[model samples]
Target: MTDRTPGFATLAVHAGAQPDPTTGARATPIYQTTSFVFNDADHAASLFGLQAFGNIYTRITNPTTSVLEERVAALEGGTAALATASGHAAQLVVMQQLLMPGDEFIAARKLYGGSINQFTHAFKSFGWNVVWADPDDIGSFQRAVTPKTKAIFIESIANPAGSITDIEAIAEVARNAGVPLIVDNTLATPYLIRPIDHGADIVVHSLTKFLGGHGNSLGGIIVDAGTFDWSKDGKYPMLSEPRPEYHGLKLQETFGNFSFAIACRVLGLRDLGPALSPFNAFLLMTGIETLPLRMQKHCENAKAIAEFLSTHKAVSAVNYSGLASSKYNALARKYAPKGAGAVFTFSLKGGYQAGVDLVSNLKLFSHLANVGDTRSLVIHPASTTHSQLDDAQKTAAGAAPDMVRVSIGIEDKEDLIADLDEALGG
Candidate 1:
């Protein structure tokens, strides 16, 4: 077949995949084996030593997962990508590759509750400190930067609250500081926005969300934009300096622009062992094929829901970026013009108990921690996801006691609205 530049839909289905060379299988077969066969001792040695890029173990790489990685990279306009067992695993790998003990990173306060815990508590054990900045204040990111700061992290559309970050502004901050800007594009998938095109040096995703739209798989991917020059200021010694593990070869010198991918694979995945399963990779690929279609409907439904909630007597405030009155509406238009995404939060006029009652009363919306599924989801963040945080922290992160988050799905708009109406009445 002739090589043709494929569009988003075509690449989602065909990129990083071809018929199996050995068996001529049309489907991406899960190489379920623990390891691969080498031609001889030298071949095995080269693979193990990282002299050649081949699967040494299932924990390091798998053929099925590789296709998923490549497809995600292409979709995100990234040079390469690494698949991991979970979104949390992907974040850990990125931190391990870029940060050393005593290094710091800046992140938006409006982030996933799990990510906040990972950055503030778990990452603290590694001697990496996170400086929190308000997503609305671009100058706050610049002010938070210290000499020890190595990276800047933000969610393209923050979890629960649906706040949209100014990727270009944040990227500028990182650029001025000579560091990489990392964005979590889980809520706003590549179909809505590709962070790399907006100046992000690296993009991360919880494929368990929209990319794995069925909510049947748990996976994550880190994509390298291949635009940042690690050797420019020698800040990232891990990439710019020689590594004894690979016979003292410098990653940037050897791998050029795609060195970040090589570093994550060789140093992070090889040591950390958070490899994504081939079965889950297959599931995620299936979901990604219809991502554009599902996301469009998701946004449309969410806009309707947000509009309804804003005018409702029971709702004190609505935080959907699609709404004209939303604090993030301008940023949404700038970064995600296609749609403001599905996940959003609103405050109940009746307070915490009413929020809980409403969640329980809803029939169509599933009360779950996940988002981006075909089915609508609801959660009381203060009682569930952000319960661990203190009152002060909870308010700072926009998870108040009266707050209820909704992940609008492709369900019938009227049905969703009626469910919310009945729930609010109760």
Candidate 2:
């Protein structure tokens, strides 16, 4: 609104896109080919040497994917972005750049069950350690930091629980420790809260969710705030050290603000081999165009459903931060003032069996493992999403046996409430 620039809605549709120069194609054309032709040996040399920027291989970059990256970067107000095969891949690419063997990163105990598993098990295999901290206790984060700690990771709004994290407070902790704050803004898309604006150094997304809106595609992205001092204290070698592969070029010295994103692409994506397809990128871009509209409806329906459940005799508790009674309500107001996001967990008075029954009996709502769909979805995280965790781990992550998670959709609120009423036998 300040410099008379395009509003979010306008940027969503027009950012990073222009009329096709060759055929005037209005829609983004998927460059499905695996490689791009170079002008000559010098052009090829410059691209491969990292002296110039252009598409070399689909495994690293593509025209369609680049558009999605730029659009997301613009939305998040980041210097640059890199699209990946999935959200997990995006996190992996970011960590691969920062962490070395025996290094540790502190993370909030409450997170998506999949991310918890990924950070706990997969990262251990890489010789990288994960130290847990309670997001509710700022002192817990301070205690978790050590000399080897390289970063702090948290969700803007945790999945299933719908708990809102105080990103600014945690960012202060990271700043004091001289480490980057990596925020998983998957549930709270840029429309609701841009993590970078709240002091995050790197923002990651599960494009499979709200960013893609439809459940039709699997994609992810990492937006670089381009604010971190990678060369400070010489902690991030991938950015500060000269690379033998690129004729001893130091990425930070070369790219300046966007160096981290460029490192993720040329170094991580190229080697790890988790590239997003041009087709999926096209699908995600289409979904983002309607993000503002769908997200508003989602928050509206979620609030209505949360209100109804809170007063229901069969419901014991609801974890929606949008509710005034929620412990996270103030933090939600500070961070995601738009809404606390659509995904939240609730417990039934009937306990675990009742939770299972409610999921099974839902008529209009789907029982599935995925969220952020146009259609209402319900699942018992104890039995599905967080099934891999032990009892203590599950409880720590807020997936109790009596809990059922719901991803409220952009559907008719009346129909959605009616379905729940019938399902609960009211």
Cα-based TM-score, every candidate: 0.96, 0.97
Which lDDT tens digits does candidate 2 get at residues 1-426?
A: 467778898889988888777888999898899999999999999999887878899999899999999999999999999999999999999999999989999999888878988999999999999999998998999999999999999999986688999999999999999999999999999999999998999999999999999999999999999999999899999999998878899999999999999999989999999999999999999999999999999999999999999999999998999999999999989988888899998888897788788988999999998889999999997778778888787676688888899999998999999999999989
TM-score of 2: 0.97
Q: Name the lDDT of candidate 2.
A: 0.93
Clashes of 2: 0
Model 1 earns a TM-score of 0.96
Model 1, 393: alpha-carbon shift in Å? Answer: 4.8
Lowest lDDT 10-residue stretch of candidate 2: 391-400
Q: Which stretches of candidate 1 lie over 4 Å from their true place?
A: 1-4, 387-393
lDDT of 1: 0.90
lDDT of 1 by residue, 1-426 (tens): 997777888888888989998999988888877788898999999887777778778888889899999999999999999999999999999998889999999999888879989999999999999999987889999999999999999999987688888899899999999999999999999999999999999999999998899989999999999998998887888899999888888999888878898899889998889989889998998888888889999999999999999999999999998999987888888888999999988999898899899989999999998999999999998888778888787787788889998899898999999999999992
